[model samples]
Target: MSPFQPWAHGLNEIRFQGGAEGFSREALSELLENVPLAIAVTLGPQQIFAFANRLFRSAMGMADEDLIGRTVSDVMGDRYTPEIRALRQRVFETGEPQELKDASLMLTPGTTTYWDIKLLPVRGGEDQISGILALAANVTERVRARSEADLQAREAALHNERLALAVEATELGLWEWNARTGEIFWSERQKEIFGLPKNEPATYEFWLSAIHPEDRERVVGGVGALSDPRSGGGLHAEHRVVHRNGDVRWIVSRGRMLYEVVDGELRPSRLLGTIIDITDRRRDEEVRQLLVQELNHRVKNLFAMTSGMVALTARTAETPKQMAAALRGRIEALARAHELIRPAITGSEPSDGETSVAGIVEAILAPHVNQGSPSQMTFEGPSLRIGPKAATILTLVLHELATNASKYGALSVPDGHLRITWIKGAMLTLLWQEEKGPTISGPPKAEGFGSQLARRSVTDQLGGAIAYDWRPEGLQVRIDLPLSQLNA
Candidate 1:
């Protein structure tokens, strides 16, 4: 027989005609002792605990003899709050059963338990409810299981939200395809990655149509291989796509397959992947590689030009001092021009066709301006900017002038000074004037490479006119060039 058989038999016996007038005290005692559920009886507003079964006494860590006829507040102390007393009182007044699931019960400061409680009113012969009878079953394990499940669900949702935020912030598109069902799920970013309008139905056909004709077969083959059960760990592929507007883009897809068993056969079920747009990044890398190759070629060409200049200068010099001086001046001018063009050649801002005249002048004159005695040089100009070619030519012209002053003109004398100035007019006028220098009588008996190159650079290369005046105390040179040509 079950442990509750005695209680059930007693109640059934009392219901039958000609049965015992009331419960047998001995049988009632035996029934309470054998029942596994805890039982308690309380009476009146004071909540006097009239009776408690063995299970109830044991659960409360007390003896039945000591608990009998004691007030609930006196037995349970602060643990029996007013709210719980009110709930018990309502059950006694209504003469109905009040069930509570997973009610928490505190037995000690550190020990607690959960219960499934049923409170039923016990009535007297007059039909007036006189006491409350409570049946409580321990439900701690079930409550703990439910609480853990709720926490797991919350943690899973938080993880998914974090993954979604990461994908959106990186502008990556996610996709999942159920191979067996032929169903595809695409993230919102996937549509945007393909440059497609949102809210448009994204079907397999729509995506396949966007793939470039040349790449469609390859993409399909890669996907098939990745999803094949016989094939391995994962799959990765890069392909091109043609947008609706006919713009081409590069895309990289990476994914892994999940498998399931059906009919005793392991079959591929889904493919989960991410798609990244790499068109811009790929183009930038290609451009950088090309620029590196171009820079190497330019450096080799510059070396060859320097070698040729050295040979020409060596053959024309009549003495060691003359050759040394010529080499120094020519190399200095070349170095200055190189400094002006280096940034442009490397694809930095103010590149070829976009450099400024004022910027060029400042870059070239920076070295001289830092000297302790910089009174030897002065420059004045209007606000102006010119293209790389014009800037380069102007840098060379100024270099030649400065080199001449340092070697044989105004700057060669301790008290001498050189004034370089420019003005904007119908055309641009630039002047290089020297003061406090040895008197300039005329040209050298034979023109040197510097003078010849200076004249050619201004007149032929720059398409500008030049005038040289040999004065008793100093020299003055003037140049005029079209502003439009210089800016271009």
Candidate 2:
């Protein structure tokens, strides 16, 4: 027989008769003792315990003490507030059922439990309510599980919010696509990256169209591979985009595809990614590459010029000492010119810390200008930013001219003045004139190595023209150079 069989039989008999009045107290007590629920009966306004089953006594922490005639508050302690007493009184007077769901119950000082409680009014033979019957079921585990889930949801929300703030601070553009709905979502920065207006709706077609024609095929193929299960890792692509404003910019994109099983086959369900503008970095890289090539070309030219100078000096010198002196002077002149070009080529700053035409001229003539009063040499022109290659060629040409004037022209004698001036328009025109210097009978019959090199640099390398006029008082040289070549 089941352990509850005897109690079940008596309880069934009392319930069959529809009331507890006819049953013996011993029979009723035995029936309630073996029941699963926490059951109790309280009488009068003080809610004095008339009967408490084994489960009820255990829940109230009064299993070893007498519970009969004890008030509900006196047994359950302070956690049972006045509101509970009022609720019991109302239930008894109205002869109605009342309930509390997931209510906290503290049976000990430091321990708490939850329960769902129902209070039904028990009546006497006259049908007048005499007591309240309480039934309780523990719900502590269920309430704790729900509270834990709520906490996790809040933490996840906070984490996502922080991640979004970090992404915005870094200026990254975010995008998401849903394959099932064919819908796309773009953050504001994403739209700005593509140069799209706020009102414009972003679509997959528009994205593909924005990519430069040369890179569209490759980018599309990479993105398409995200759907293939065989392909591992996320999508990473660096390509060029033609903005709505017709400006081409470089961008890098990284993303992963989300997949779900459909009909036993894994298929892509969503795509999410971020984009970063890399136009400035790409341009800097290109400039560095151009600088390397220009440096190599300039080194080769320097060697060729040095070889020619050696051969020419050997022919003219009557002695080895004279040849060495000429070659040393020429090499020193080249070194002075290179001092101006070094900053630009090596990515350092010159003394004046400038990379313009005026900066270059001021640096090269600093030595000569310090020797005489400022009035002896004057410069007049607007400053233009020139690249390393332009600065190198211009430095060599100017250095050669200055050396020639110091040796044989205006700078050779005191009281001789040299003025340099330039004007910019369709092209750059410069004048190097000397006054009050040794009279010039005529131009040299044969072109020297310095003159040949200077002419070649101005015309061939700089795509400019040079002319020398042997005036009676002094020599005047005119040079006209293209603006494009100078900037390059």
Candidate 3:
């Protein structure tokens, strides 16, 4: 017989008129023992077991096959049998049926089993309660599977929560792209990366515009190539982007194509990626490059300066002592000028550690100023920052001018004076006026090294204009520099 056969087998033992399926009493009892469901018939108030199925004997963990007259407490232990007996007694008293679904049963110590239980009260010839029939269906596996599924769902939720928190802490900007529709979604952090204002709409053109000019075309083409299925369905790139305020930054982008079966065919629909700010790293790389360029230029300049000093000393020195002193002074001048070249600080705030333009001017002129009147050459200017590149060239130009003045110009006389003034607007303008000193007969016809250095400092280093006017009173110099190059 099937394990779940609905009909009870050979149930002809009970007395009834016109019983259709008559069989020997012993034969009926044997068939009842072989039935599928856990069934039992109990007799008397104690609910003694009058008959028990093989399944019921196994559930009770009883060794004896014949359980015809034993009390339930005798076979199933007193700890649990009392509750079963109480349930039977209630059914008998009320003449009602009982049913319990998904109820816990402890058939063995430290082990739990679930059951769907049913009980029906039976009566004697006097219509008084005499016996009871009970049935139980096992539901342990079903209940266990449901509990396991609930635990897995809770764990999955917790894992996603932790992943989101980590992404937030690291300031990773998230974005989702609809490949076929050309639609895009940018998270708040992603908008910040793009330098977009609040509530600004995002579009593919906007993304392209944010990329650096030199890198934009390549990036756009690569994105198109990503749509090809043979391209491994992923994108990884490092490129540059210009912020809305004109700041340049490096971007590391990664994304993958998403697909789902539609009509049993895989088709791409979405792309997702994350971004982070990498401007600082890009600046560090540029600083390393600038260092190499500066070293090469300075070394070449040192050789030229040494050769010029030798040539100039030969013309002015008459004795061994005079030549040595003159050469030493010239070399000292170069050494002092070198102090003005600050370390290269590249990137947006390149003037961060550099000194002010006025500060550099004062340092170069300190040796030429009269000790009693340190203000012999007065200086005036508003706050202005100068980068190392501009400061180096300006230092050389000012040192040359001061040296010339100390020998034949303003500082040569006790009453001589020079005034230096500058202003900052769209551009920087600096004027050097010499007065109360020897008159300039004429401007130099031939440009020498000092003149060449001064001119180059203005045009090459400062990216500005320089002019000289030799007046009857004294020589006047005016310099105009781009305000941006001063790192203001």
Candidate 4:
């Protein structure tokens, strides 16, 4: 073979033995010089570059003389590290061939590239190396793609870490409930919220059993409301739960109801939510409520006492003008108290100027009692909403009872108490009992102005019946009103 014979087709023979079968030595040289991949053949020991193809010379910005007979370090300059230089020559000295995938190169200034490289020994047919064959395929695109994918994976992992930190900072326990299966997946914090062991199975029944009995029904109802479109697929409630260790904790749960349509009907499928321990907040609210109640009681007692004083002031007038002045003062004061009781209904015309039965009762009787007077006057009943007309009629009936109590019944003594209870379902039923008051002899033989007004209010306006049971201890009045008419 000529020293300047370019290069042989033996490169194809070494790795892929018969790959160059039909090609002559001159034909192989012509093929490699124009091939897309960079190829170089170098002489032994010194590993001097002997044959440089067009693609390889173009990449190095050199002609044949610049690359041919030049070592890898000579053409590639100092761009490659000493370790890589040693690796290239180590194959030559040891007659060993090496295959490298995704090898990096910086032979040209300010440019980087990658390649799939194969370094193989060329022998003289005696199993002795005569030269080295170096072949490489451009792999920069594949390497860039793999690098981008790795970067995206790392970014996603970082984002999840940040989200977890935010959730922990908010002290929120996340949970997901599978409605159909009754299985629940709880986050680490949620398991802590439920006082479950770090890794215990969380079933729907486990959550239900933790609720305080008193709150279970209301909580369940709140959750059930999620099925109603009016609820906007949202569930929210404040309830008490008993931990496994018997500690009662108050929590506020807020969540969204997930649904899927099946068989033409909407069905609940999942619920995702957060639970927050609100025991401290609820306790503070209760304390504030108690304080407000105390203030309300004192204000009521003061107003009632002032009304009584006004009546006494009326008796002490010296002249007609003086009597008129005193009477006008009392009237003005009573008007002010009325203003205080109703407070002008701050929002939205008071349900079209209507109010609930409880609202009416509270307004009329709030001026008469303090905390000590509950036994003297108290209320017991589920809440009921009533229109303004019924509230007015009921208000008048209650006023009459209170007036008689002040004059000759329960309100007359410190210990005498008035208890008002009502039940509303099919009909509205109310019971007014005056106990420990001055003994009532019997129902009055003739109805007074107040008594007649109460009768008319109940029967005509409220569509109800009113009867009195004059017991030995006190008076018990029973009133039952038709609900359909009142609601209408």
Winning model by lDDT: 2
TM-score for each predicted model, relative to the true structure: 0.62, 0.78, 0.66, 0.51
Off by over 4 Å in 4: 1-22, 27-37, 52-58, 61-66, 99-103, 107-109, 178-183, 212-235, 256-271, 299-488
Best-to-worst order by lDDT is 2, 3, 1, 4
Per-residue CA lDDT of model 3 for 1-488, tens digit only, reads 12233323222335543356655556666786777667888877887888877878788877555576887777666445455666777887886777666677788888898776778766776666787777777778877887898899889899988978987898888889997788999988888888987599888889989999999888888777766666666888789889888988788888887776678876777889888888788887776776667767776877887887688667756987877865675566566545545434323333334477787778778777666654678899987877666776777777777777776788788778888889987888888888888888888777656677789878976789889888878778988989778752
For 153-202, candidate 4 gives per-residue lDDT tens digits of 89988998998898889888899888788778898888787788876888
Root mean square deviation (Cα) for candidate 3: 6.7
lDDT of each: 0.75, 0.80, 0.75, 0.73
Note the residue pairs that clash in candidate 2.
none
Residue 363 alpha-carbon offset, candidate 1, angstroms = 9.1
> Which parts of model 1 are misplaced by more than 4 Å?
1-36, 44-54, 62-67, 93-101, 161-171, 212-214, 246-249, 263-265, 300-337, 346-354, 357-488
Model 2 lDDT, residue 91, Cα: 86
- Model 2 agreement with the true structure over 97-151: per-residue lDDT tens digits: 6777778878767888988777777766666777777877777888899899999
Output the better candidate (1/4) by TM-score: 1
Q: Per-residue lDDT tens digits of candidate 1, residues 1-488?
A: 11122222212233323336655656676777768798887877676887788888988889988898898888877777676677787776776566666778887568778887777776665667767777778778888998999999999999999988998888899988888898988888888878778788678888889999999998888877865578873879899888899999998988899989989987898989899999999898887886678668657855865686678778887988987886776677667666666665566654433355566656555555536764677778987766545665677677766767776788778888778788999888888899998778886687655566667767786788878787767779898888776842
**Residue pairs with backbone atoms closer than 3 Å in model 4 (clashes):** 376-417, 376-418
Better of 1 and 2 by TM-score: 2
Report how far off residue 472 is in candidate 3 (Å): 4.9
Q: Give candidates' CA RMSD values in order.
A: 8.4, 6.2, 6.7, 14.9
